[model samples]
Target: MKCCFGFVTLFVCSASVQAQEANALVQQVKARLEKVADYQATAQMDINVPFINAPSSEVQVFYRRPDKFRVQKPQGISVLPKGGVRINLAALLAGNNYTVVDAGTAAVGGFNTRVVKLLPSDESGPVVLSTLYIDAAQPVIRKTTVVAREGGSYEMLFDYGRYTAWGLPDKVTFVFSAKEFKMPKGVTFDYEKSGPKKDPPKGDGKGRVVLTYKSYTINKGVPDAVFKD
Candidate 1:
């Protein structure tokens, strides 16, 4: 009877420890995301959409405040979005926006990781679904899978080398589905299409976009003048 009781006690303790760990991970991720009120960083972005008959474009992006962003491409006109900040890539893609549930364990970036599934409340949202691989010890998200509502999924792997107080990732590699990918020419009408499609190019299948951000200045006093057209 004593031996049976001891086994039962050990099982209960193990279950309790796992539950505590799961809760702690959720809080850690939430706190890290909430720390960034405002930040300025330079990013190198590579975008590829197979459906679009154009070569991949590499651009540099500068971000400021509530809804200010500027993207500059070599030998191309810069894209500056003033008021409507439709999307905050870092926050929407990497930050906390979904319910996290512990899926299990896996190996990622040569580290033992805990896989967490992020489920969105609204099924009809632009992002269909996402799954994240978080480093168990560092408690930072290392990789993510984003499923688009339009039947395409993108996988992004983050290699966080430099650690900031806010725990933001410096480098991210985006690997997207290569089949039937395409960006509307109207959106990038300024650029000449050079891929398989003609002037008004169609979509393709596969693509990838890798972004590297350097030297983040967070929470600086950025006024309205900085974001003015």
Candidate 2:
């Protein structure tokens, strides 16, 4: 679900997601994810921002255990949510550096999911707080709301199909705010200086990036150079 005021309002929703057995639930999902050491997937990524003109294109997504991720779009640039956010859920849940609480319940993809809230103990970490909607029957995170310590905050909705066994989503939707989105570093644009600056463009600041996976090659060793490039 989308919160009106971002992280602040989410606390009202987070009750006890990180608990005694709540950690057990977290471990179950993490164990399910451990089945796959790595995978390379082909996806069609679409960007929907009210402010920018962008086209949908195919991209190659790669991931390795513990935290190695890359999005490859040949001869083009891929715009995605930033803020030290890694798409891999494993990377997000890795370590016992956080406390948990039960956020409540929600429905995702027609499944009732338990909402779990995670508060990272490390103040220096990029992720400040995270809310996870976990599937009731299986060990999979159906949705997530993440607030970065810096500036970005986004929610992820997962639609599983072909790779549900591995906790991989067939289609993932990332919802964010366009007005709050920062351009990639080293990028600059020309803007009209109408008397220093005018009021920011008026519109609902909703931003979305959708990735539909066409296929996945599981357990394949993705070379380390893929992430370095």
Candidate 3:
């Protein structure tokens, strides 16, 4: 009986240590990302869907502290996925109360990463669960899978190059459910001329949005007017 008790105690201790390590790693990533006060990013957005065909569009991305985000187009229209703003790492990790579990190691985009699962303590929050694959050597997150309280889930993958120090990715790919997506027809006035709408893939109705960042102006104070609704 004593031997069995000792084995159980050891297992519990091991689990506790792993949980602590995972939490600490998440804290390190949050600290690194908290350095950027604001940034303006120039990017190219490509939209591919069964209904709409959009040419590569030049876009400007603006971000400010505590959940301010705006995506703008200089010449043409821009349509983004619903719940897209959750892609911001800083915003995702903003909540202080949560549980982190170490999901172990995985290879993402040819880089080895530590996968961690975040479960928000608040039951009423919009996010049900989030899984992140973080590069072990860098403070950057390579991928994220967010499961919303609503039906479908979304996934985002990141590839880093020039802005690795700032924890920003040069390219990002977002995958989401097509059924949950909406684009205002007024915004894409020329969308129908692009092509005849085809039925989306059979099963899950998924679509992809790829964005490539051309340049970033970091630490500039963005005016509140820019983010006003």
Candidate 4:
């Protein structure tokens, strides 16, 4: 009986340790990102899908800490993923109302990193789950997978350089379902690539949007109006 009790105790301690480690990793990522109050980035947005006739457009991305984000294009159209705000890893993990679970390790962006799963405590929240691939040594998040409450999932991959110190990525790629995206009527598209919209392709056909950050201005305090519609 004593031996059985000892084994149970050990299991409980092991679980506790794992939980603490996972939380620590998340806190470390937040600490690294706390340095940047705001940032402005010049990006080139590319929409890659069979039915979309979107050409690459020059975009300006503005972000402020604790969830203020916006993307602007001078004249062209920008097709971003549905949950654009959650793409920012820092903002995603900033809230403490989620539970974290260690999901073992995986190779992300050529680096072996730890995978942590986040589930929002709020049952009705838009974000159902978020998974992060974190590099503890470099202390950066290389990729993230977010599942929405509406039964759709999207993934974001980050590549860093130049703005590495600020925990900012030089490039970000988002993969999501094309069916979830819709454009307003009367907005003329070139339709060179998009032949005809036949009832909108059914099933989970994936679409890719890549953002190449050409330059970044960090800690410059982007105003509230920058994120306005």
**Candidate 3 vs. true structure, TM-score:** 0.86
* Whole-model Cα lDDT of every candidate shown, in order: 0.58, 0.74, 0.77, 0.76
- Quote the positional error of residue 19 for candidate 1 in Å: 5.3
List residue ranges in candidate 1 displaced over 4 A.
Answer: 1-20, 47-90, 93-98, 183-206, 221-229
The CA lDDT at 169 in model 2 is 90
lDDT of candidate 4 over 1-229, digit per residue (tens): 9999999999999988988898999988888898888888899978665567566878888888877766777653432323423767678977799999988899986799999999888988878889999988878899998877664677889999898877889899877666645422222234335554434434666666688999999887898777654
Misplaced by over 4 Å in model 3 are 76-85, 179-205
Candidate 2 segments exceeding 4 Å error: 1-18, 76-82, 180-205
Q: Among these predicted structures, which one has the highest TM-score?
A: 3
- Residue 80 local lDDT, model 4: 31
Error of 4 at 200 (Å): 11
Q: After superposition, how far is residue 75 of candidate 1 from its true place, in Å?
A: 7.7
Q: Which candidate, 1 or 4, would have the higher TM-score against the true structure?
A: 4
- When sorted by lDDT, best at the front, the candidate numbers are 3, 4, 2, 1
Query: How well does candidate 3 score on lDDT at residue 26?
Result: 93
Residue 209 local lDDT, model 4: 69
Alpha-carbon runs more than 4 Å astray in model 4: 76-85, 178-205
lDDT: which is higher, 1 or 2? 2
Measured by lDDT, the strongest candidate is 3
